[model samples]
Target chain A: MNADQLADVVAGVSDPEIDVGLRDLGVLRSVSLTDGRIRVHLTPTRLSCPAVGEIARRVRAALAEAAPGHGIEVVWERGAWQPAAVTAAGRDALRRGGYRVAGTAPRCPYCDSEDVEQAGRFGGAVCKVPYDCRGCGSTFDVIGTAGCNAMLPTPVRGGSR
Target chain B: MPHIPTDSDVYEVFAQSGHGTALSHVGSIVSPRPDAAWHLAKETYGRRDDLVKLWVVRRTDMIVSSAGDRDLLAAKTRMPYRQPGFPTARRRDRSAAPPAVAAPPERRDSGLTERRDDAREPRLTDLWLALADDLFVLGNRLGERIVDYIDLEEALAVGSIGQEALAHAGTILVLCGFDQPAVDARFFDRAQAQWQVSRVVERLTDWPSLVAGGLVIAAAVAVLAERTAEAEPGAEWLSAISAIRDEQLVHLDHWRRWARALAAWPETRTEFARAYAEVTECAGDMFGARPQSQGQGVPAAAPPAGPALAVTLHERLAVLVGDNGGPGSRLPDGPRTRTWGVGGSALADSLSRGRAIRDHYAPGVFS
Candidate 1:
């Protein structure tokens, strides 16, 4: 497949747990064709994240669905993981869907209220901390550091040279 | 139609305590609909003491580790030292004691202490003991009551009582820290009823006398069964009591088995008898003290050659003993006495009354 097609195919790997596109949680850093195989560089929200396996499997599945018989391998790196740095493209989609984009103060994902309070360290997911929007009176979880908690980053693997 | 989340769907539940605090894993919950899932999450995870807020997320959306490496965080080695075996155990004792004591002093001992590694063994043992004793006593009572009677109603009543007692005993055993998932229904079918009776037994402080009386009757029946085999060989009446004794023995053995749980829950003693009584009532109308009008009014005379005399004698004895308000009857020209004592003046009156009943019935048969 062409590099552009592969990029889109790679981008299709969403966060395995949230079902949100990888481009949204910002883990899809880059997609390039090095040698014969396609390489996708990926980072999770945390290094010791629990959902890394699931994320990797979903990525493989997405790739296979896009291009049947496509060989995929996932290499997860702990560094370059930041919940705040979700990509612009991904951020726009998440924002359009009424989810607060990563980075900046996490406004209540539910009400988009900046006037929020920390409800608890634990949220709906392992890495997400629940926050209450003072303005909207709703509670939502902010994805916390990955590899550190249950939340893992978007799935990506290096191309076979 | 709202979609119900299958087990595969994972929801990220977030609990908020107050403001700006981090949420921790209180627990996990499963459900179908997002809204319904949220409620289920709250019930299962939030019902516990730790949780205040809950979040539900479909599992499909969440990222997770592979099944192969799920135990990476699991403690592989003994970390006793991390909790209590530190080298500075002495030094920390001085510095940490006051603050540890100060932080939620009420909770320090009652809550955290319960979770500590040290207290669990003793606490579990205490619970086990209480459960065992409670079941054991109840089992003894049940075994003594089980009897197969000639009359269908009486047999059914006895069977129900036995079943209820065993049920209570079995559950008590299971709950006494035994990890069994289910109880043998044959052993204790009417446990709820037995528990009610147990409550009453606990309240009646004079229960020892009643229990002792029951035990004595059981023993006497056992003796009579043994004698039946030896004397008047193959007498059906004696065999009947023997069969009843066998059932009673089984009940006793089962109780012996479950005594551990009974000992664990001492507080339950007060309520068990009352529960048992309620259960018994549900099983059937109790055979409790029926007015003389209701019981078999001295069954009609049997043929002369039949062993009716002995049966009539016993029935008469039972009626006479039952009459005079349980052993305090004034016999003509005889000394007044309590009825239960062996060979007491009351016994003489009972014997005479029984003989009179036999003669009176025998003439009717002849006539």
Candidate 2:
């Protein structure tokens, strides 16, 4: 397979948890043919994330099948995965799947109501926070911005939206 | 008479929205007591947020670092090796064929190996072992008591703090040139008498005692780690040590907050004070001289002096329990001067318990 075909095969792998393609999720940092071998670099969402090992394994298996007899290497890059790295298409896909991406203003996922209150700074996962909607009377988890510094005190309106 | 809450009674509120999630700082509330603070936190934050757990610690109980100490609490340079991905990246690099062109020659002597004026001081290995063992022992003891905590939030916090201590211990062992298997053996199979842990960590019998004793030892360790990091700027492990010291500060803050909270309450006040006194009694010798092995002539380096470390510990303890007109005011002064060493039966018991758990799981064997 050519470089483009090889890249496509590598990008086909999806994150087990998020169910998004590696390329769309910004996990596929780079894919290049170096020294006649296929080398793929990936950056994890978090250093201690359990999905990293599985992702690497899947990537290796996918590449081996796509480009037979070619040596394949999956290199994990040393750096934090930034939420900003999410492609626009990836964001849209995530939203369609009922997942909120960080940096966007938080609203009720259920009713799309702007009148929301933060019920908890932490959610089921480290990257998410639980928010309650005054409109729908339901709580939903929103993917929080990457770091604690991003957690500014969001203003809450007294009246209905 | 019921005490009226005031601005001076500000409490920092932390909340967890789901089971097994860590509590994060949300905001602050002003209340006279912990119970009152919890109620106010729910009233203030629960209206909009869906909080399942909350922690209300008084602002006064926090140990804030000064602006000058920023470097001590953070890594000044990138430490790629510290990241989980580093080993994989390194392995890939090694497996790749060597570059066609020859690589540049390595430096003859990095500044790390150069002898300094304080060369006569004790080796970093000995100091690291002492610090690592202390944390390892404390981590095990704290972990053992996690299930005993009635409150889920407290139990989670204890488990997290314990895990952090163990991680720090492992990092220190790595710095001392021990691989993963070596670290496991040193942690689980080492003889009881060989442990260099301070006496303060060994006698934690109950919740109140754990809080008080943890506060004292955490303070001492934080101070010692900071001093070591400052003294050894050229050390290769500087960044790692700084990172560990930063987490040590967090541990210190947790213990400080709990110690103060327990002392302020009517129910736990007397018990907390008694635990504090008992721990401090034997804590004096915590910073004493490192004992030399038999027939080993001169010690490599002198341990941080007992009085100096004791003075720092005293000052910090004072900040926690000193001027407060509550039950803490009645507690004894900081650790007195004495020789402290590893516990005998306490160490044996803890080690045995750890071995039992390890055997039951039989690590490396899949069920």
lDDT (tens digit, per residue) of candidate 1 on B1-367: 2233455745667776645666755556556566787877777666755554556667666656555664774678955444544535634553453321111112112111111122122221222222222333443433333331234333333343334333333333342323232232212221221111212123212222223222222222233233333444433233222333343333332222222232235764334334323322221101111111111101112122112322332343233322311222121222111111122221222223333454577444422
Candidate 2 ranges beyond 4 A from true positions: A1-161, B1-120, B123-126, B216-250, B280-341, B344-346, B362-367
A1-161 in candidate 1: lDDT tens per residue? 87678767767777766656776677776666655555676765643245766777777777777766655656553335566567666666655554553345667655566776655332343345445677878765566542222232221111110
- Superposition error at B154 for model 1 (Å): 58
| DockQ class, candidate 1 | incorrect
**Reference-based lDDT, residue B238, model 2:** 58
Model 2, A106-128: lDDT tens digits are 77666888787766433444445
Mark the regions of model 1 whose C-alpha exceeds 4 Å error after superposition.
Answer: A68-70, A92-102, A146-161, B1-367
> All candidates: CA RMSD in angstroms?
35.4, 24.3
Taken over the whole model, the C-alpha lDDT of each candidate is: 0.40, 0.61
Q: Which docking band does candidate 2 fall into?
A: incorrect
